[model samples]
Target chain A: MALTRDDVEKVSLLARLQLTDDELNSMTEHLSQIIQYVHQLDEINTDDVAPLAHTLDITNVLADDVVADCLSREAALQNAPQRDEECFRVPAVL
Target chain B: MSSPETQPMGGTPYAVVVGLEVHVQLKTNTKLFCRCPTTFGQPPNTQTCPVCLGLPGSLPVMNRHAFELSMKTALALNCTIPYFTKWDRKNYFYPDLPKGYQTSQFDLPMSEHGHLNIFSENDEFADKQIRILRAHLEEDAGKSMHDEAAGVADSRIDLNRTGTPLLEIVSEPDMRSAAEAKAYLQELRLILLYLGVSDCNMQEGSLRCDANVNLHIDTPAGTIATPIVEIKNMNSFRAVQRGIEFEVGRQYTLWQKDKQVLGDMPKQTRGWDEGAQVTRAQREKEESSDYRYFPCPDLVPVVVTDEEIQAMQQQIGTLPASLRKQLLDDHQLTAHTSAVIVNQGLGFADYFLALATAIDDSRLAGNWMQGEVLRILNEQEQTIQQFKLSAAELGELLKFIQSGDLDNSKAKDVFAVMIESGQSAADVMAELGIEKVDSSQLEELCQRLVDNNPKIVADVQSGNPKAVGALIGQARKENSNVDPGQVRQICLALIEKL
Candidate 1:
């Protein structure tokens, strides 16, 4: 029902977001308001009903295992911010 | 056996607790949620599609074959399949993960509560059951190649492996030592191979494993458990064993100084530096809550009927454990010998079965399989399927030895020639000019040798049985095709009559 600054910090860290102190405080309040707004659904007496896993009523939407044509290397790397000859380049992970 | 490395400084014994998380790439024609071919070693990022690349407005649909293969593997491991399972989005921050999340199963995994029995090669440990906690199907991430040598400090991403179907099998911390852990991995790999679900090729990254290792020490005060460290980057099973062993020792030494228990610190993630043979600390492991898993709204839940589960069970066929037992029971082979045959994989096992059935001699067939056949396979770097000699041909060749028509030495020569020339047993024998000496001809040859050697015959008749060895050698010199055992038997009888 409520969020803490520590929780916001942890979430930000996991999301790889760098936030300043003011941004962290504002985010803590904003996220808490969003959680409180969503918690309004708890007021409904839906305990008897099972939790819905998906919005749709259908199940087992599957496709057969068949290979289709993929994009060319140039097309795949076209949108990358930076790329090498055959791969998308990013900041070193290690 | 408790080694000194596993023992604490206070003369207290400790047990190494290792739980393995094996990730096997499902052998499917396409990616899990897309039609892009899941081929390895292709040009980087060439296999990308709208769905696998996580482009906006692209809906992801599950691959039917990938789920079925996962079910087949779960059944083979004796796991309980749930009737209903749903996918969840595991949010993470990694460059290789194009979607910024991995689609995996959360609380409701596909299968759970299974066990695999692992057998040790030696008396190091007894057969034990490694319990499976859960096995869930997930989409694999792409590969990140770091160019440290060029000092670029940039990493290249290969999205070819993105969206590939991977089954993550999590085993309980049931292993007590490094050896047991290795055995568990080996047995699991063999089963996966037998089911034809995954290639289980460690070199190709089709099969990968990360081990959670810790130590439970028996101190005078009470039992103290070290903080569990998850070791990754072990490319092979041997590396896994050595990594766990090294971790066990390192934890013991660390505990001796700090006396820290499991909760004193957060769980650590370490990488196995195989070159240095040490597990270096990488980072602290995040709790499951850090992943912020939530049900994915894009994909519908999968529901399996009882009939479908039964069909999958039937499709699994005979697993390695049952096949090993069958090898022991039907073939009357030793446990070690049966394990060897089964571990060579299903093709080699089938080859042995056909050959043994044809010859009606299990031990002889097992011996040949372990001795000559395996040797040739290793030397030629070929699988049993690639072998030149068919089981029927090998059986026919062994039948000569069984019927006393060919001696073991000559039979080996024929076997070699048959392999080289791709000829059948009869053809090879004929080509080598090796004719089975008829029983009467063999007897006549033995009689000539016995009569020619009067002193040898007198010694044999006077109770020196070994003196017949000289006459058998003479019979071999006379006719190289003569069976020495038959010659000895006929010569001894003739000398007794004289």
Candidate 2:
């Protein structure tokens, strides 16, 4: 259950979080504590009990296959930080 | 666990284990989670909605048709459908992925534990059954177009394909060679097309495949296993086959160079350089992204009922394999012809079968479909939908030929006319003024020919029956519309009387 500072740094990079050194140190400790707390459930002998996936007991909650009104082009790209006449442009990706 | 047998390549013994991950776009009216129309090739971002664009506070609702289609496909593939399944968030950062994560099935998929049979070209693994590990449902990412064509440096994102429903099918590493992999893909595509689950068109990106390949080589002390390399960028089945072939050799050579590379190496990602016809390493193990997966908080878990599974199982019609077998065994069709008929696609197969059933001659129906019908259809650039002749019309033409009313050549002419005018055979025949000559007129022509061409008649009576061909030609010269076959019969009778 223990998490190292390196683990925190790796996860931060993966999440694209630009954490300062102070925050990274704190995050390492906080994540370790959270993991230790969550690891308590592993101690329980619930071999027979099925793992729960969802909080609700319902299944097959679905929407009908129907088309609805979609946002117009102007409205859709309204929140886009960078856009052109037809598309959202990003920096060069390789 | 079944391991594929070792195969020898380039005078060295090696075992190639290939697994596949195929993504097939589901045929639905709208996107999987949103109300945007799931149409391909539309203007970029036109089909984007708040939900699909991953805007704040936008939630995903499961599409009923997408689930139904996936269920139908799973059933056709003979996968085990559990009573419950749910979606998970596969977290990754890519420009094309607007949501920063894809809602996909992780631990529990829609279906699993299935197998597909392939007809491999290699004699060692012909008619092999490739085990399917699982098939899950997921939403597709938007396309990122690096504007190299436009001479622009910036890349553009087309969210039109975003949120489109896709079925990702994962196969066990049961394929030993590239040919087996290709055959497996072909069979799987046929099944999906038969189920009407997806369009299965690779050109349109409706269907895509990536292969995970590794090599096992026998060494002095023990078997040495190479690191698994997952290859992408294969656009077609042929590309997949060639990519696997090239990767197999590359991995074996790399393994031979350094035996220590096996245990230390992590699963590397490669891209098929289609022009170079070789797989180029894209990313090493350390550079690989770890997708933090978790349950999607928005969409609810799907519960498929037993009754629903039963209904879907029933909905799947006779699969292509069984139908091909039936055509071969019961209908007495050659394997090549049966494969052609089966692969002509759903509509054409139905039309061909219907014509075969109506005429009670599967062989002749197959011959006509393979020969004249296909030739004309190809020449005219038409599909069965665009084909003017119905099954009944074709069946009637076959009946006419079978019953001696029309010869094969005359029937071909009639078929051409029908295709051109989109008219029925009877109508086309009438328009072309094609008819069987009456018996009385044929008899009179025979008598005239016998009396005038005494030498030819004597030659025929003296056992040179080939002389009758000249008489039929003369008779045809007199009345161009007369049936030459009928004229030959009449000449035989006249010579007998003489």
Q: Residue A8 in candidate 1 has what lDDT? A: 96
How many residue pairs clash in model 2? Answer: 1
Which model scores highest in lDDT?
Answer: 1
Q: Return model 2's CA RMSD, one decimal.
A: 3.6
* DockQ, computed on Cα atoms, for candidate 2: 0.74
Report the Cα lDDT for candidate 2.
0.86
CAPRI grade of model 1: high
Residue B454, candidate 1: how far off, in angstroms? Answer: 4.5
TM (chain A) per model: 0.90, 0.81
lDDT of each residue in B116-234, candidate 1, tens digit only: 99877787887778899999999999999997766699998999999999999999999998999999999999999999999998989999999999988887788788999999999
Clash pairs, model 2 backbone = A60-B303
Candidate 1 iRMSD, 1 decimal = 0.8
- Return the lDDT, model 1, position A32: 95
